[model samples]
Target chain A: MLIHELLPLVGDAQSVVEVSQSGDALRELLRAPAASAYRAYVPDGEKMDAGTVVVAFLGPKPEAHIDAETVAPALRELPVGGRALLLLGWPVPELPYHRLLDELVTAGLQVLQVVPLDKVSRHGAHCAVLAARVDRLAPLRTHLSDAPLDLAGEAPDLRALLRLTGEYVFGDLLSRPLRRNLAAAGDRIKEQDERIRALEKEIAARDATIAKAESRLARARNDLADLRASTTFRIGNTVVQGARRPTRGIVSVPVGLVRIWRKRGTPGERPGPQS
Target chain B: MTLLTDAEASKYWNERHQQETDLRSGGDISFDEATNYMFYLRRLTMLMDRVGLQNNPVAPLYLLDAGCGKGYFSRELAKFGHQVDGIDGSEAAIAHCRELGGGPRYHRTTLSGWRTPWLYDVVFTVDVLFHILDDAEWERSTRNLASLVRLGGKLIVGDWGEDGDHVYGNYQVVRGRDRYLPLLDACGMRFDGWEPYRFRRSPIGLYTFTRIG
Candidate 1:
């Protein structure tokens, strides 16, 4: 479809000049249509006749993107007023490549229509920039290209003025939602950040309150322990317990009081080894 | 120091504006005058060129300097023949702006609370949103500013272009792309691009968007 779709734009070809690297699928797609097709694996400045369509597909196989070194030779071989059909394949993201376009235009090729190749094309190319060699530069409508979405393998290219659009449009329609989603996700992140900050503050306050209560509880427990270990409380408890029986109070009360009196003066906290 | 409450932050900024009379009051106070003159002002001039305002675009383009600190940008824009209005939360800042005004009308108003009848062709908030410590306030401010821009108008803000929000010191928080993009997209504003200031160690820059009908 790449050759068939562009065959009309090629016009009445006196001869077809096919230029590409050796063993590339692009060379196989180069059809002459009623003229003898000349193959140049590595073009070494072989000049051709006028009305010859220089058919070439430059893919990013051994190199990165389309470079001038590979493209210039094809232009060098192309005679004046001849047409050049180039299928450009990019390894980078989908976007308006002005640098590459400007390079082609500067090379004395008056770009006619840029046909963007689909996924199933013989060569997996970004787009086909169709142009003819002209003497003077021509006026342009728009730099951007678009066409109706075609399921069929028919070649597509050139449409719409990008800068003149009502809304500023970009290259990929698919990435639009992605960009929005990423942005919305950021909003959510900020919201979550606020929530996290609030939660952390609440947690810190709760921790302080918990610590204060624990300290007070510890102080109260210590006070109760000290009260129970007092000598007066022990003597009082003994007297009360002995008082429950008649004669027991008389002996136990005096004994408890005497023990308390001795224990009060004792230096050791608990009875020593001898005691 | 810890992050300040909204009231405390407002007080801090107002007091700051009152204390300093020069560019140091609103811009980076640490930077010397030479550095500011050579780097800071030059960077802004370049950005204005990128914004399509440097060469004097269509005359008298209505513009709003959202959160215009001390009214420098607003005054500068007004000098370009555009009707400019500046609003800031700091009372002292607005007072300073009015006293030194070349042309712009100054108003003392917070970004979130800012409400007006007029819609501007360009509403720009530079190095301001990061100062709003509260997240909800930041969102509201961004949304409100976007709302202020008429269709086919521009809304430019200064913030980090990278992903994820970053907190610096007490009052500064750099909200990333996720925080800004989705919200603005929902507002029908197509993002133009984000260009970094690229001065000193600063990662901050201008994020530009154009509202669509």
Candidate 2:
């Protein structure tokens, strides 16, 4: 059976047993250890002998059939320090599992450990499994006598364990590529920031150039105003204010003065239309 | 001449016509307004008489009031002993036509969709062609109007001649004199003549054509 091949992966077992109505799946446990035993039991009919590790493979039942009466009696029949591995395919609601665990403890059994097994298959039908051990039933009398039963453990029920495992697998499948893409996106954002800074610097340079051109234009206008104020510069008949004095040879004359001088014909002869 | 049946067209024009009337009247009903209405009716009667329509009544003259806003011209033509019909896409305009006392049977529809019940002696569309958005719709509408006119029947088109884009009330159009003549000629209608009417006051020109058979 495949279970024999798979049990080695779970580490060593001193005394393994398979208790199922049908001996097919139980036959797989024959390869666990040489001391392992297998048994088949009818519902509510058998009690385990001393020091036997009772591995019970109960088949599917209706949700209403799973009560303390149906489970506690069989679990109480186990001897002290004798381990019992019970397999079930039902989902346990909150507070109800605690009550059921309390009833099992009250029935002269000490629970050493409880393990939930996921990914269960029975001749191709998917199911969940629960495994527990019976510690010394005598020490249970003083263990949390006044307080409530402490069934808190890391392992969840079989259904929840399977769901959690599947979710882990799916989460890894979805987020691994997303994490890579996010790193690439962060790099692109940094590159864009650099480009934006470069563009800002370029804009600042262009703005400075525009300011320089404006200042130059203002200075040119001031120079033009100064040039227009000269006495040699004449607009229509008016003379400008600051210019060279009118001397004999190198005098700078206003345009109107030049025209008048030319009209007067060099201060002597008649002005013949100022040829 | 063009027959049109549009379901929503009439109701839309009717509402618009009501609103326009409300705005135009401004809640005033003076004797002067009544006199103006009567004067318009008398002028329309005289025009119809001059057209020889009053003397020899024409059954279903197949008149198309191009831009027949509220069917003002159509209603008058119908009252003057002509079996006339008008079509306009404006809901308010169509509603006004329906409200008018003893006017033509008016339809609220577009020129592109008008289908004449029979060939018409006169297919008249006034001040409507330039509202066409493009040359394609204009050509199609013009051809459709021209096709309604029987051989030797008159096709009258009134629009702005030789104008840049201009606005009148809510209407905007671009038109010129030579713009439509070639198109009309190609649609089996011969240009009879055109008369310039109200150049300064209205800037409108009325062109008359006849189906060439």
Candidate 3:
């Protein structure tokens, strides 16, 4: 997701001026360690200086054209020898990278380097980086009309073709699998994280439940033990045992009753203690 | 007269449910968005606490989520060991609820039409009745929801906790406390005090009713 291709240009820059409709590209730009002082600007009514790094993010809309009118003013502000890095959200068939380069050259910026930033940038858009040096402008008597550019063959010229090849190698071939694997791994980790959280919650709930049940069981056991040690329980036990003796069956109840009466009549006859 | 027919209501909900990817997506009210999801999460948790649904020792509380769309609350309550039945008129919504498989039985029936041999210990309808445009149908739905609750059990309704009902967006009949209390009284359900939902940005709150008979 990090456009490693733009690292070299950005690695040495101290101050970066980012122009984009959304601050997303600017935020990504500021992530580089080289960007100690980075400020973002919108294309409308914005001013910039030359000799500093400038990044412009354009497109995702093929229907919308990026003309010299939009690109020239930003470049004009850049002083001589200033670096301009143009990143397109995606390649529009109508506005090819080479045509954009031609527009920049016409606008008084010397084309230095043109390459695809990555096959797919963090925004899920194809991006190309065009690093140009601002130079003294030749006075323009006439404005160039928007016209389809021809680059010799079915493909763009060797310079553009070479950049395209680099795009395939560095952007698609190198980063695609890495991105896929990282995404899969991230998803797996996230799933496991969610599962772990759910399990922890469940375990905590079960522990509470078990503790409650254990307390309840302890209380029940204590109640049962208390019942066993009670005076009433001893009298009932004695009567039952005495009744088991067949010879004394008729007198067993009276004897047991008298014994309980004597126990109750005794001084200091506490119910549990007497039992 | 019913402004929106039963068929119209079902179609509206079914289409809306089908479009949504989750419980919080594709409605005028949504929780799928991050901010809205947070709001809904807080509101539901607070509502549960207010209704004594959180850490409830009274497990296996047979709960009826009347007009349960997509079974968010039903599934959550079922997690707390309550046997929940989620009823919705939208077939798509019921199907989606069944797919979630969180242990709540899904029934495709409107509140007025819903029938069961067993009564629920806690029957609740959250943010569902406002969509019923017909006044008579609303009364019937209220009565039917009350009927599903056992005596001394609760029937919690979610609506505006204001004095008088108002209609919003041609469908949502914001039933106020004044409108609900008499209807609940008629059905032998006692009007317990309303507990306002803590995180709701609006005046909506939990309308708790207890069946006395």
TM-score of chain A of 2: 0.33
Q: What overall lDDT, based on C-alpha atoms, would model 3 receive against the true structure?
A: 0.65
Task: Supply DockQ values for each candidate.
Answer: 0.01, 0.00, 0.00
**Number of the top-ranking candidate, with lDDT as the measure:** 1
- Pairs that collide in candidate 3 are A50-A79, B24-B31, B24-B32
lDDT of 1: 0.69
Give a tens-digit lDDT track for model 1, residues A171-196: 24545888899899999999999999
lDDT score for residue B69 of model 2: 68
Point to the candidate with the largest DockQ: 1
Judge candidate 2 at residue A233 and give its lDDT: 39
On DockQ, the stronger of 1 and 2 is 1
Give the per-residue Cα lDDT of candidate 1 at B148: 84
Candidate 1 chain A weakest lDDT stretch, 10 residues: A141-150
| Tens-place lDDT digits, model 2, residues A1-275 | 12233333223334544444334555453244655555543445555655445454443454212444555555665554445554444432212356556755675555532323323444321221222343422211110012222223333334434433654576677678877898899899999999999999999999999999999987777666655444333332233322333352234345556655555433322223222
What are the lDDT figures for the candidates, one per model? Answer: 0.69, 0.51, 0.65
Judge the docking of candidate 2 as incorrect, acceptable, medium or high.
incorrect
lDDT of 2 by residue, B1-213 (tens): 222223333453445456545322211123244543553354344334323432113112445555566555666676555567777777666666678746577777778778754556677775566555555766788788887765546677766667344544322355665766777777666687766553235466567776553
- Could you give the interface RMSD of each candidate, to one decimal? 16.4, 49.4, 36.4
For candidate 1, the docking band is incorrect
> Which regions in candidate 2 have their CA more than 4 angstroms from the true location?
A1-275, B1-16, B22-54, B57-62, B101-103, B163-170
| Tens-digit per-residue lDDT, A119-143, candidate 3 | 3534544444444453332211101
